[model samples]
Target: MAESKVLYLQKVKNQNVSHILHKIWEHEAISRIELVQMTHLTSGTITNLTQELISHRLIKESESISDSVGRKRVNLRFDNSYYYIIGIDIGRTSVSVVLSELTGNIVDTVEYGTEGITNPEEVLALIEPYVHKLLGQAESRKRKVIGIGVSIPGPMDQRTGKLINPPGFPGWAGYPIRPTLEERFKTKVFIEDDARTSALAERWYGIGRDGRDLVFVTMGMGIGGGIVQNGRVLHGTNGLYGQIGQMSLMTHGGAGAAISYDCWENLGSIPGILKRWSGNGDFRDFIVQVRAQEPHAVKVMEDTLRMLEASLTSLINLYDPDVIVLGGKLYPYLSPHMEAIVENVRSRVFDFVQERVIIEKAFYGQMQSLMGAVALVFGHVQENPLLVLGAD
Candidate 1:
């Protein structure tokens, strides 16, 4: 009978632990008292779970505190350093690898030109060494790597973790990214659209912290968006919810719809704009001259702004998001154009949405997607501690 009671007690403890882990993930951080109240569990239950978490290095006592009447209350917080995640952002011209703590802080990053990406195996080979090297520098072993998160140019099927006709990356279509990486590293892997990943990063760590519904717009080789509603990314039936670039903004009877007309990629994609304005000149040199405010360069900037304004207006009308965030390589050059775009949006959007909507540049730098991939790993760990902690 004593042995039976012990087994039953262990089962009860496991259930209570599952509840505590869910609460922490939902709240991000919580006090012991708050956890008790939130879970409606006994103080003993909370204490046991918290002790277990601490022992497992899942959480740590935080430096931040709230002063109580007697002893100060040292806050308990998730220990992001307990593990690390690898984030890969593969763009048209380059691929970037970031090693980030569970809390989304980047420990190290490596950017390499993408001359060999036509061969998927070659790209993976190049990435593996850099990842191992970074782990060595950080004194972290492969066993500590929680997962690998990859963000690439879309359109992709998130459910299958495969690229489906990715525009810029011709050879990557139908690539078995998640399984390939998982097999190679002997670890879990996640794959997501680049724009969607960026949006996730903004929602958790950047400008979207205060707003639940937002649209993250990426203006680079092509334009795309990621939509978040009620704190969850809106992955559509096809797992491509926010492919806003395909929308037809202009009435041109082209292969793309009307929304595609105003899309920066279609009319003013970075390469497209350079091609349009460079006039047989060196495109890189032209951009440099534009940055220096040469007279012709000023005209190119103005043209880019006009297209941007029109595209933003269409987005505001369609989505009515709480906030619209501009990010990607082109963001720096387009910073000067924001005011004009905002004004255009105001003029174009209906009064109700115009009054409530906010347009802003991304708060996070170029590495936002990499950080988001870390968030994806940590978020999963928090949601299902069973994935980390075994039964009792």
Candidate 2:
């Protein structure tokens, strides 16, 4: 058989093994009997799979837990500290790095300001020290580094493992982020668009845990977002799916429905909003001004919310997701007005079905992107258990 075909066949053969591990990890601890029940695999098969994972140190036997009858049962749980995943979030304003265990619990974090630094080599230089620092911390804990995950600005070329003219970072257009990091770390590395990383964060740790469809939006910088449907991030052709900022607004209503190209990002960007709201304050100051009921600040916020209501109405109709999560610098400021925004969207949605869409604030704080990076590696392990098995 051809090499490619052989490799493809090998993946599913161990899918059951990996599935068993996920069940164990998800529940924190479980017994072989529970695994068989959850996975619907035979008791013998569950035994073999659990044994295989144990042999690799991917999971370990937890101490006996007494049941209702006081019978000691051996519970299985992930060897949380046996392996580490490094997550990096490279934002326009700063770079954040974190080391996390198998359970997605962050251990150490490093942050450095970038102030929109886009020079590829300079960016790499800033990241290298933090990466080494976290790796050092992991080694102190006796955890082997398994892989690295990066949440970065996009439009990235996933197939080529390169950045493609990322916004405000044009010079990094052709940088090979994946290969560069893999070479530096001597392990597999994965890069995902920052927005999608938030969606992953939700799927793994936030509201997305309940459902298969999720949309995460960032109101800061520009109106960026990511889509998750059926538990998979959507990377359209050329990896440019989540351009929520550019989603054209329905400027007017009619059969012709006067469409405007003035996207939310352009109209609602930080500079533009502040510029419109008296032109004298940063976002924080603007929030204070709004709280103080300053006319200009109040007016600008109202205007933005009007468009936000329209934008969200359009979003719900178009995507039809189970939930839409909003976060970023602007979201908190909008908290006082969230009820109004939701009510307006509810009243404006196309029909009753679209009105059922649940819009909520982002569950995580600064940890969103960084932890999203952690989710990336955990996702890879689910699909390819060899990361823990020390298989290439």
Candidate 3:
């Protein structure tokens, strides 16, 4: 076989092994036959891979035997006690850090609100202490930390691991978040767009688990999107594939109109909806009136939903994904009109594609982004076992 083909086949084998290993990790204990049933890898393949993992000390054979009757079955499981990972999420309003076990369970978490501060250094300060605390906790517990994964809001240079002109963090353009984290934590670091990371988490642990092609649209203070195609989060050139919020729907002429700004974020974001509301109350009160179907509240919501429908229609037509997951803070407002929203989107897309795509709510709710940060590390380690397993 050609060298490229050989490497491709090896990658496929590694992916299969990783999938089976994750299945074993999720379950407290699972037998080889069960692994075959869960991952659809042949029993022989599972046996060989599990044996390799056991020898590498990445996984282990459980002392307790399986309850199968025909043959004695030894169970396989991840060695959670052996290592740890840190997952951090930097949002427009808050920063959260989670310590996760090898199996992807959250051992502990630290959070701090940003309160609208956008300076790059200020943002770093907000998260740094929590990151240190989490790292210290892991050290005290005697767990070796292997990697750090972070979810940041912006366009990132995937190759260089630098944030490039992120909208949420104004002064953070061109910051080297990944390299800084790696140097500070002294571990492998990975960075991904916040919304896309959430989509990854959904694929691994939520509703998208059963489907390979999916899109997650987050309607929050800012609008964001995460698109998954063929079971992987799509990262286009420079890793800016999921910046759906910047896609323009219309153009307007005004003072400084040369900028030609009419992005989906300005049109369909929660803050935009709140700004349009004429009432003298806060967001909580506005939501109360919206649920009550008050006239002004209803009108703003209808317009917001219409704009969202237009943006989402464009996305569905472009990607033709199997599912679209709606999430984030604004979902509560959108939930009451979800049936209509989905129907509206379906009506706008091509007939042949509409019926195949299902619209649903996010499984992890608002925690999706934070959880996704952890999933990123787990995913990296799974794909490259040598990172966690050393030269074994």
lDDT of 1 at 141: 53
Backbone Cα, N, C clashes tallied per candidate: 9, 0, 0
lDDT of 3 by residue, 11-38 (tens): 7766777787667655658888889898
lDDT of 1 by residue, 76-108 (tens): 777876677888877777778988877677788
For candidate 3, the per-residue lDDT at 381 reads 72
Query: What is the alpha-carbon lDDT of model 3 when measured against the actual structure?
Result: 0.79
lDDT of 2 by residue, 1-392 (tens): 69887677567546887788667756778999889889999998888778888877888999888889998889998887488889999887888888888768777888888886768778779879778877777778777888899998888888878988877555678889899888887778989988888888887777775436988888777678899887668888766787888876544433777665577887776765876676565888988888899887888888888888888877787788888888877777777888878888888776767458699888776678789998888877776786566433
Predicted structure with the largest TM-score when compared to the true one: 2
lDDT of each: 0.75, 0.80, 0.79
What's the residue-level lDDT of 372 in candidate 3? 87
Which segments of model 3 are wrong by more than 4 Å? 1-16, 19-30, 33-48, 55-57, 62-69, 250-261, 275-282, 288-294, 349-356
Q: Rank the candidates by lDDT, best first.
A: 2, 3, 1
The candidate with the higher lDDT, 1 or 3, is 3
Work out the TM-score per prediction: 0.82, 0.88, 0.83
Q: Against the true structure, whose lDDT is highest?
A: 2
